[model samples]
Target chain A: MRRLYELLEQDTRTAGLTRVAVSTVAVLVVWQLVSMVVTNRLLLVPPAEVAVALVKEVETGAMWTNAVATVTAVTTSFVVSVAIGIAVGLALASSQALSLTAGPVLGALNSVPIIALAPLFISWLGLGFASKFVLVIMVAVFPVVVTTEAGLRATDRQLVEAARSFNATRLQIFTTVTFPYALPFIVSGIRVAWARALVGIVVAEFFGSFAGFGFAILAASQTFDTARVLGYVIMLGAMGLIGSVLFAALERRLAPWRQE
Target chain B: MSTAVRLKIEAIDKVFKRRDKPSIEALRNIDMEVAEGEFVSIVGASGSGKSTLLRIIDGLITPSGGRVLVDGRPVDRPGPDRAVVFQQDSLLPWKTVIDNVAYGLTLARVPKADAHRTAQRFIDVAGLHGFEHHYPHQLSGGMRQRVNVARALAVNPKILLLDEPFAALDAQTREIMQAELLSIWQETRKTVLLITHQIDEAVFLSDRVIVFSARPGTVREEIRVDLPRPRDLHVKRSPEFSGLVDHIWTLIEAEVRAGLRQG
Candidate 1:
């Protein structure tokens, strides 16, 4: 009965990639049907047209350059965010007074919709990679700080005490016990940060630069190239999916205790 | 100096203050002396501060009054001289058996290769030789506690403090662990201070069992177990062993009854 109940629980978690594959296929079929009925070439494009446009764009090698530009900007910003975010997180978690005072202030800052400030960054830093870098870092850093703070706080007290009893210094205790225990949560924060940085880069590119994937989307839309726009959207979706899978794998590798 | 006291707990008291409610007394004027290389166990009813007393000895917590002295030196904070084996969830889940055992040595700034070499021996002694690379969560409750012991022993401490180290194990596993602990103690002969509530465990392993009254815990009695050395499971059924267990049980029973009446 327990086994049967588990089966009937609709636990999509256990379904894994099969669920992703099924949902993607379902969405494609509906898109194809809608595009076939729409009739206007400038309106909605069929999945087949989008695939063809994606291949053509890739063949021209323009897509690769744009992809590299977007990826590099996002990756650089992500690395910066992770380094600063973890430092800020450790600082906040280590001191109660600092956390109590600065924590809500950080929350208020993060709550201000990041999209609304993208144009401001673009104006301040100008149209080059600098603005996108700053924008992406701003968007990605908060979750890493918040999640890392929570993770560090969640370190097992007994483990810390055990380390202390062995005469572990403060630094040694943090390295051996607290940090490793907080690693799984830290990885998840990085994953969230990675996705946010991608969004920030795209939005930043949409407003200013004519280089990255966001520019490709804007350029395609200007020429009424619906299929090319859809292809770029697919690329973003694929990046998101791949990023999530990579982070999940990294979490498992770093924290094998959570595997069971 | 072979017969000298290894640990001296003098007039130690602990009172936990709550903001809204009255302060609760956890331990009161606890005094005990453990001889060199002796195996001592503190057993009492719940809330009797047995674990608190052990933590004080380990220097994890400071006493409200008085202090703990090891070999005439007052213990101000946790140091490598005393190693503790906690009840459960003490092993770092991320670390492998060997790594966990090596942690204390690493903290002492022993080089990586030397730390592993020292750790490997304790891992073998703990009977966890084959599962050295496995994480703590992958191991059974008993095996994890074995690692805990190995980790404690790896530091080569002068005194070993155990806080109900087998309370989480199953009946069969607990018995096996008790025998393992006895054999380990026999091999190393470190001055051992174990805190447990199990009367039989106290009778089976300790040279002397110190029993405490319930909350605001104070030493009520200390019973000596005159059993033979290198004890096995078979010795547990002996009449003398049962008599000591019964005596400790009765002392704890009165304390428990008194606790229930107050509640």
Candidate 2:
């Protein structure tokens, strides 16, 4: 058994790809079998039917329009959240007084489920892109802030002392030592924030939106079009997978020294 | 050694106080001096607080009592006049070898081109020429420590304080680093103070080895090493060298035993 395990580990890249393919095929077969047994078009749809619906949605260009809307909202919220989150994180890390006063408040805010704010946001901003944008920012910014602050705090004390020995000023130490040391951590935080942003935009659209993946899913489900709903859900899953992969690549590019 | 005192420790005392626990005296009335162009080592047991003394001299730590003076001037804070090569590999993981070496110069606001040039010279001296662009994680443990030393030297400080800089390396690497350090010391001729528990290492590199007693550490003895200059690894085998090492070991052996009993 040990020998077999070692052999399997040798060509891990190829073996991993093959294993993924096999698992996907198994899932598809099980899904098709379940769908046939259920025999309820409203409740269940096979992979083939979902694929057909997805292609039709694409051909009609409604999927493109909804996708564009969701992507725009997510990207805008993500950019704004990262900028504000990093700035706030740096400030909190640098100032003991500010952190003492604000840390608990931020923690309290983070513990409150961001979706709970959807009604209040809609009441304030109305059922428009602005509400969705604000909702996404609320959900996404905390991870970046928490992780950035943690990273800066985690810098090795000896490194800081070495900088001090060189007579490095406070600002010089932050830019040259503290900030670069936290880059990898900040990148990982951004990845988590991206996923949260997607969730926020979708849920916001569900509450009230003229266009987006969540709106499309809600409209299809109202008519009991399970295949169209599944298509949009699958697209969201794909978007998340692609975003995480891209972020992983970005982490490697930005902090190659961290890679073993 | 020159007659001028480069660094003077005047009755320095360090007491670590905790919120609830009784304050522990780490060092008591520690007084010593390193003359100009002196290579001095402070050898003690693990809890002797030799490292604390070095940090005090570097101005990284404020002594609870007494003061540290360098060139007759009282030291209060970390300044470019003193550079420390820490026991741990403190190189910035995000920076390349060249950048880590140039860190001090950059902080001093030297032009980028001049900083890199000075850094390149030290990198070459430390035998890290081709590895300029490589990051800290990519280098071997010994190589990383070399970078640590080079970085300290690049700042051109008046005094170099090393806190067991080779304590983390394997035995073979430690010996190689010791020799390299000696050669670098010879070339630079800066006032050096090294803290270590290793008796032989202290004997081999220093012009004077000051032995510290266990807790509430105070200078127990200062042994002058008359070992001829331009020493090599073969010197360790010499009768005089072995005698000095044995003498220093004997001086600290009782302190170590006492420490063990207390713990």
Candidate 3:
């Protein structure tokens, strides 16, 4: 017990990690108790049953098939969104005319619900992964575009003046000063949009497709297998939380001096 | 100090326009000639436009009304021939000390390996020997200022334009930087145009001090500093340096008071 305590206290990072894990478990336990009190599996299942059902699905490869499919769709959509978003964002930021023209359209987009257009996507692209991909594109683009534009616009005036004082070519200023300074913001947009993209794919899949984690969850609900449905939701929650963590790690890796 | 008229500011005037208003003259009817390798300081109270004058000479800002000539040619815009060290260190935060210093060379399309090697030489001269790999955030305010100095010197401009480069520094750091600047200037003998509000810094560093009036800044007085080359900070303790400060202060004292009253 003393050795375990020493390990837990070895470093600030380790100590923080241990505290987070313990609190997470505690919260889950409390949630399980509350769900048990309700005594209705259909409304909410206990944590133990959810974990067991999760394991059983994984063992049967039911979870893997749907998880892999969902992951691939979301990832492909994210790549497309980021590429177009960054390009458009930078162009808009660099040109006042473009930003003025697109400002209203982007504002409308931020307020428009992705779910409101799910039926339209299904009708246009059919009951397949294509519609889900389009949903991810719409969900993901806004964040990336907004974040990248903000970041690009946020380039320091002093830095620009300094570069100008050097008679730096237009290309050099963009390559050296503006782009690097905007990187942190660009990564932030991508990370935030990624969460939105995942939600979009799931919603798109559930409403339109026959295969995917969303479909499996829907199937589980129809059969009243609440524990299995809980497992799929938990898996998604974990994937989202982990993906966000990976983005944080990536930002740190790219800006090592910012680690402190 | 050695060569005749390396730079000439001929009938320079600058007026800044705000939206829907008559233009405000920042500098008017200005004329001065700086000999090669001379260290000159332009001093005035805030808004007195001493900095604006330096910017005009550096071609960082255009004078709405007159002209600046370097080597008897008009300066239309900023070029590598004139390098400026701003009030803030202005080191690119993301880059390491060496990389920041090497940026001009890199922009000039010099090879990376060669740029680093060249940058290292000046980095040492600026007393930033051990800080080559350190980012601006990792360094002290003074250390970052040293990198700023190193960067300007890396390109080896014929003249250095310093706009209150030591103002951001603490008293102790300012002293060290002033000494470092003197040492660097003596070694290179580059023409330098330093702008400052500090009277002591002006008298300490300049061969000529061009004092400007409070607003619509015209040259109120130009005091020639006859102190010898390679003078130490100990010189500032001397009766000569003290007398020079008192002299320049006399020239600007009334303008400074009027500036305060207007504000």
Candidate 4:
């Protein structure tokens, strides 16, 4: 019976992969049909043209430059935002006075449409990496702060009492019980922050930047280079996909006990 | 059991006050003592505040009126001298069995190696010898409670306070765990104060059983179990054991009915 169940499970996994492949092919076919029917290269190029443009950009090293710039900006902003946000989050969760003062301010900031501030940041910081970095931090930091605080606040009361019964000091309880308990929440926050960082970097680049994926797309669209625009968009999508996969793996590693 | 008192609860009373609501008298004028190396159990109806009394003695909750004394010293705060196994499984879910067992020792700043070594001995005592690397989520309810007990024993506290530690387990597991707990307690000879609703469990493991009345809880009676130690499950089948269990159950049942009538 166990062997049969294992075999059935393998069959379902194989079927899932087959379905993904079939869906991709179907989408490509539909794209080809639409492109052929339209026959307007300026508006909608076929997937083949987009792929050719991608290769050409890579051959000329433009793709590498743009990829390197966006990757660096996103990673640096994400790291800084996570560190500062977690520190702020821990402070707010630890003290009622701090949370009461700062929590509503953060909630208001989060409610603002972050993209609207991109131009202001670029104007102030002078259309440079600093503006993009600041924009990404503003966009990405709130999720980390909010989720980290929520996670810490949700630490099990019974567990804390049990720790106290063993005479665990406050710091010891936080480190051993509270922090580890909040890890899954922190990782999820990082996931949201990552996607927001991508969006922020793109918006910052669009407002003003010398070079990046968003800049390349903006430049391509200005000249009606639809294929190149599509190529950069696909690259951004792939980056988001890779980041999401990595965060999911990290969540599993950090919180294996949370598996249902 | 030695005549020396390991724990003394003197006139402890607890009143819980809520905003916009009347105050609750949870425990009233409660007094008890546990001798050195004695296994005592408090059996009471629901809402009898027996668990609250255990928390007061563990120093997790302050008594509104009186205080708890451990070894001639007043307990104003939770300390290493007393350890508690809460009703709920309070294992650190992220930590493995060995790490969870060593948690108290680690908090005391025992070097990691020494803590793990001591934890290993208690793990063996708790009959969790081969599952050192398993997480709490991966263990059965009975096994988790075993780890809970092991964590408390690793600290080697002056007194072990268990608040219905096996209440969440199934009947078979509870009985098996009860037998194992008796063996472990016999081997360690630690002074233990347990709060349980299970009358048979109280009779099977305790040297003395203290019955509490319905809330505003107070000690209604204290029954000394004359049964011998090193007890196995078969002893639970004895007529004497059943008699003690029946007597305690009658007391608690009356309290339960009374509480229901008042409610």
Best prediction by lDDT: 2
lDDT of 3 by residue, A130-200 (tens): 99889889988988888888888999888887887877898889988899888888898889988998789
Q: Model 3 in CAPRI terms: which quality?
A: medium
DockQ of 1: 0.77
Q: Which pairs of residues clash in candidate 4, taking residues 3 or more apart in a chain or in different chains?
A: none
Candidate 1 lDDT over B1-263, as tens digits, reads 16899999999999998999999899999999999999999999888998988888888888899899999999979888899999887888877889999988988999989999999999999999899999999999999999999999999999999999999999999999999999999999999999998989988999999999878999999898889887899999999998888888888897778777887
What lDDT score belongs to each candidate, Candidate 1 first?
0.90, 0.91, 0.86, 0.91
* Candidate 4 stretches greater than 4 Å from native: A1-30, B261-263
How far off is residue B157 in model 2, in Å? 1.7
Residue by residue across A9-35, what tens digits does model 2's lDDT show? Answer: 664566655655666788899999999
Span of 10 residues, lowest total lDDT, candidate 1 chain A: A4-13
Query: Per-model i-RMS in Å?
Result: 0.9, 1.1, 1.8, 1.0
Candidate 3 chain B: 10-residue stretch with minimal lDDT: B1-10
Error of 4 at B218 (Å): 0.8
Which of 2 and 4 is ahead in DockQ? 4
**Considering TM-score, which of the candidate structures 3 and 4 is the better prediction for this target?**
3
Clashes of each: 0, 0, 0, 0
In terms of DockQ, the best-performing candidate is 4
